[model samples]
Target: MFGPDKCRSTDKVHFILQHKNPKTGKFVDHHLKFAPSVPYDKLSHVYTAILKPGNELQILVDGEEKRKANFLSADYFEPAFIPPKTIPDPDDKKAEDWDERDKISDSDAVKPDDWDEDAPMEIEDAEACEAAPGCGEWKRPMKRNPEYKGKWHSPLIDNPNYKGIWKTQEIDNPDYFELDKPDFEPITAIGIEIWTMQDGILFDNILIASDEKMFAASASSDVLSDCQKKVFDVLYKVADIPFLEAYKNQIIGVIEKAEKQPILTIGVLVSIVVVVATAILRLLFGRKKPQVSCNVGETDAPGNSEENEKNDASAPHPRRSRRET
Candidate 1:
């Protein structure tokens, strides 16, 4: 099981075992026959039968790829210990195990048609995914709160401003409405910053159960697993790492200097100058605009049409038109 691959050959195979006679200083050959279906488990002492040129050989396991196999030579392999017979589980339980904690009907299985905010349901907040240093495989229940467990990882912490995480679940309140599922315990007091695909997690808000958390922590140790930590350091930062790590502290200073040296550095200065100049102009011209006012008795003057009528009566036109009565 330790080996990545297994091999099986059906043919009647023979292995040539060799030994040297100490008195004559000459080689001796011993032949060993391998039978089909004789598992590697049956082999008593695989290490004693070392194979060398013109000295020894062995029949390999049947039905295996010969990609890494060496027919001409064999390395000495030893077994640690033989295992006892496999035992079946007492519960006779498989992955399909189902239990009836509460009486409910399977006739019309109900699924949440859509997430309704008004119902006061699971409000997933914080993003589920952040830079999880070493998050592994993920799976969910086919039914709500199915029996399952596996390793998982939470996203790395980013903000120093925030305190430790808070965990919440819907509580068992008589006022809360239960779903169609049996003993459908509604989640109570969900983490105010919930985590779910509904909100499309872009943050590290997923908090696993204690048992699930233990699985992840046990699968790895220290800061990060060997495979997980390699990602941060293995990348090629030729200009920095190979020669500059020695003066890592100085590198930050160099970066700050470069950041400030942008040709666009004068943009802020220019913007400030413009704003100050405009403010000064507004202040200087504030009092110059005309201030209009009207006397207390003043009313709108008569229209020009009335003035035309008065002029018409006073000065007659040169036409023989009848005057107004």
Candidate 2:
């Protein structure tokens, strides 16, 4: 079984080996838990565990070795089936006068003569009224009192009676047994028991084979490499913009190049400034025509009167003229 160390924890991964103890006839567990070297969320990752012939264990993530140790070593794995070789002595007991304290209060401490325990922590400012004249009834602000002294306490000193920690002697256990190769059980069934708050956990391409070469062949697929290539291509496209392609490698590279050729750097900066200033000038003042205004009561000119008489001689009158009668 493989899972996390606890519920809702995605930071660690654990591999458990369950088998029936030959001596005790009860089922036991051996756990190997560690933090993953690569991210295990929002992306597919390959997890592999290999048990070698010499009781050695190896854990890998994305075909990279992360943790390796001996399965029987007490430093790496938790062997719950094995009993301790020596147990604490039941007959041993601590002495009555055993002092475990490291420090005690000093007995020679005394209070100073000028220390005032009853003094207030703050006092009203006496010169506030004189500083600001005609300010109505100005309630003076309070300042920290210089004469106030906090409660006194004696300093601590090392205790001479300390005898250090007490411990009991060990004895050999009667039920202790040793196993050189604990991986002797036959493969029958496999199961997984897990508790996690995360959703949409996927398990794919699970391979259980006796030969290590078969497992290696399955793990060497192009899934992870293809994903990494796609991410790099996206970043390349985003950096391929005008005036940025020259420094697409990194911003630090641009600074180093600018330091080497200061003349070129100044020319590029002046060009950018000129382009921006021209755009601003066109936006503020462009494509506008002058407007003309005329007075409503202005008199007509002499050319306008002759044109009006010619127009009246060619028009028909509304009333009959007296010359026709």
Highest-scoring model, TM-score: 2
For candidate 1, write residues 27-118 as lDDT tens digits.
44533322223233311111111222342232323222222223322232111011112333344432333332333334344434453324
Clashing pairs in 2: none
Error of 1 at 62 (Å): 61
Worst 10 residues of 2 by lDDT: 254-263
Candidate 2, residues 1-325: lDDT per residue as tens digits? 6544434434666777876676677777877645444454444556788888888878777678788877677777676446688889788788899888889888887878888889999999876665666657667889999998887777889988988887887888765778777745776776666555776454556777888777677665513455444643444454455544444566334333333333234443444446545555666785566332233564447769787556555754434343235
TM-score of each: 0.13, 0.51
lDDT of 2 at 272: 40
